[model samples]
Target: RARPGLRVDAMVLSGGGGEREQEEHAALTAFCPGAELRLTVLKLADGRLPAQWEEAKAAVEDLRARTEPDLVLAPRTDDAHQDHRGLAKLMTTAFRDHLVLGYEIAKWDGDLGRPAAYQPLPAHIAEEKVRLLQEHYPSQRHRPWYDREAFLGLARIRGIECHARYAEAFAVTKLTLDLGD
Candidate 1:
């Protein structure tokens, strides 16, 4: 979870190209009240392909150039969704020296891979996260796999992997520890 005092900035690349984009904005605003939110709604006509990989990469590169954040959270490279995979791969180049955490999004594609990092969530925080997702994205609720069970079930599985009651998993391609810095 992002601490309230921390400055959090998020860039939402695609948003299903409609009301979902607006819903995402609203949800993110509520989730990170004081954080900076950037939404780029692109036309992804094909679910399996992105509009333009070079353009998306350039956009992300611009964001990185401007923000130069200490950490970046992006979609996992092996995500079943091609759009996500493309962005994830591009992120590796954009934030080459930064700590990037690849987040997993549960979907019907069922492409969950073994994650190397675990961020344990408190019971209440996990419940709240599920509740927020359900509340914020009414359009996604119609999907069979978008229910609480799927969300909580994946969290539970990840928790088991990390020896916690509830947790979120991330793929870490690289990391640098400055223990004595």
Candidate 2:
């Protein structure tokens, strides 16, 4: 039986802002330690992605041309933050042929769009993930919920969907299934 998820060949992160990408990078490493994780960085002016969508689109396309990943995970199209929303839309346009997964960063306004592909992290992995986030991203530590609880909490809630102990949510911007008859 084949698993549904794509074998992530290379991951292209939009930027290092908001600790979201950093967390994703961390999770990707822990979750898929054996796979190669490639990065494409676009450091746009913070909080100014909507107007600069083209720059992101171009950068990511160039990345796709180079890495040729089976799957491309980006931000959610509908999100509390404009950057997240903008990047999601741009990635959707760019990676039409690849499986694009959207990641969730908990916000006060709620996860604007429902996620499709959820990675259920084990309890210990979730805790260790929080620790890695705190240790590496020192700049975000003072910020609220950038700590252990929020990350672990989100995972716990997602775990409820399948009675798992902990988990992380991701949205699949595009996916295809082959149901054999």
Candidate 3:
């Protein structure tokens, strides 16, 4: 809604096949209506991405072949999850010319850190995001950290950091600023 002509494309490198993949696809659709989503289930064992490094890198290379994204949103390099960390490490290697923003996934591992960038979210948008998460991903509802409060609380903290009511944070390992010379 913010950017009228913006084209959004999401690529999921690690996924379980069948029903779980379908559920994730549906959730992504609900979260970003009209966005293009591609799921490549490498079928790597959970928390073992480091062991399946070749396959992970291959999947990312394939995505790079298909899309030349201007900006890429990927898991933070320092994320606790092995799958997330593996994918994050590959993002810059594959999308060398694009700006890749490493996003955080709040989870039980407590890997949240001081992010270098922030995207301010209005109250309405923040609330809607939490509602969508609750409504679309039923499987995750059981997790203690999957409730509205957890989401909103993190948003609130990030908001304070960025001087906004609510916000999303990202870790940027490198950035090039273009101030017209």
Candidate 4:
């Protein structure tokens, strides 16, 4: 709604083409009805992305060959999850010209860190986000941190930083500003 004609192309690199992947597709569809979503699972074993580095790199390289995204949302390089860290490293190399924002995933590893950028969300949108997370991803319901409180708490803290009711934060390793003369 913010950008009426915003074009979104999402690539799921580590998905295993299982129930979880299906749920992810459904969630994305529910969240952004018109966005284009591409799922190209490398079929690598979960949590073993580092071990399959070559394959992962190849898959990302293929994605870069096909599309040139204006902005890329990737995992943080310092993320504790091997898969996220591997992909984060690749994003820097693959989309060197694009503005790549590293997104943090709340996990048991407790790797959340200070972010350099934030996008404020309205109360209705924030509440809807929590609802979608719970409703679409039934597979994640078992995790203790996968509840409403955890999601809302983080959003509230981020919102306080940006003076909004709710917000999402991103870690930016590099930025090039153009101050037109």
Candidate 5:
């Protein structure tokens, strides 16, 4: 359950490809049949993203040409992984008009770029979220928690800046606000 003031309308999966993506999409849909989640599997060949940067860009451009959303969430360019950086730039170029936010998965060195928005979770929620990640992403069972928790912990710590107990971080590309004043 979310906080009293929090609300989630829909979930969209972007830039996931390969067996892991397919399996995760199926499981997500099954777990939340009524959630109306749209999982779009980008054509990039998984770990081969850096080698096919232009292709990924074209795929995102196609996504932009076909659909539009008020906001877009993508991988943070701060990542050490070239794939993450490519996807981040691709999303930024494709959804130029929407709020494109980046989500980080902590990597070596100083997580590349900095993020601006943080979405906090309760300690309990954070633990549960990590559990879910471990359970669903068995392919990552071998990797150390630093790759995962470091990311979430950053969110939690960043959230603390905004008075949240725990949270997720995002980098926005564009944002529009209505001035009621």
Candidate 6:
């Protein structure tokens, strides 16, 4: 059966600042051009982890109630940060049937684990991905780990794991495979 087209809903449970959030939204739009986009901006502070958990979880549940998504890109449950882990748990709870791909955020904490799945990107597309991040998210350029080399290097490493030229990795708790009947 032919599936529905892409409709992506990105939930920014907590943002660092207004400018950062704007940059992030622009970057996401550039990356996923032509997709129906629904973005929720929650400007909760990092210090307020407890509050963020309840509010973000409730928002996720509410969104899931109204929309049926084919795929969900969320933070993994093994995420080092409290906010990310909490959000991942809630996303898993809310999206039991849907395909939930838990993505990674490479940071200094050394939390990168062996991802369970991989999606290969073509050479041109992978190059474009790095270019978009550098162009759209200028605010993040100051960060030590935000350079193009760092981004491409990680993609290369993940690609090596999956035997692709470039790839994004994800943690999958459960997946149903359909062998040809």
- lDDT for each residue of candidate 2 in 64-154, tens digit (9 for 90 to 100): 5776566666677777788878777777887787787888876666664556667777677788778776766665667675767787778
State every prediction's TM-score relative to the real structure: 0.88, 0.77, 0.91, 0.93, 0.75, 0.88
Per-candidate clash tally: 0, 1, 0, 0, 8, 0
Score candidate 2 by lDDT: 0.68
Cα lDDT, model 3, residue 18: 60
> Between candidates 3 and 4, which one is better according to lDDT?
4
lDDT of 5 at 74: 77
The TM-score between candidate 5 and the true structure equals 0.75
**Ten-residue segment with the worst summed lDDT in candidate 4?**
1-10
Which digits, one per residue and each the tens of the lDDT, describe model 3 over residues 19-129?
657777787777767555665555666678788899888878888898878899999988988889888989978887788899989899788989999999999999999
Per-model CA lDDT versus the true structure = 0.82, 0.68, 0.83, 0.85, 0.65, 0.82
Off by over 4 Å in 2: 1-37
Residue by residue across 55-74, what tens digits does model 6's lDDT show? 77788888898789878888
Error of 5 at 31 (Å): 8.1
Candidate 6 segments whose C-alpha is farther than 4 A from its true place? 1-5
| Model 3 deviation from native, Cα RMSD in Å | 1.7
The C-alpha RMSD in Å for every predicted model, in order, reads: 2.3, 4.6, 1.7, 1.5, 4.3, 2.9
Clashing pairs in 2: 102-171
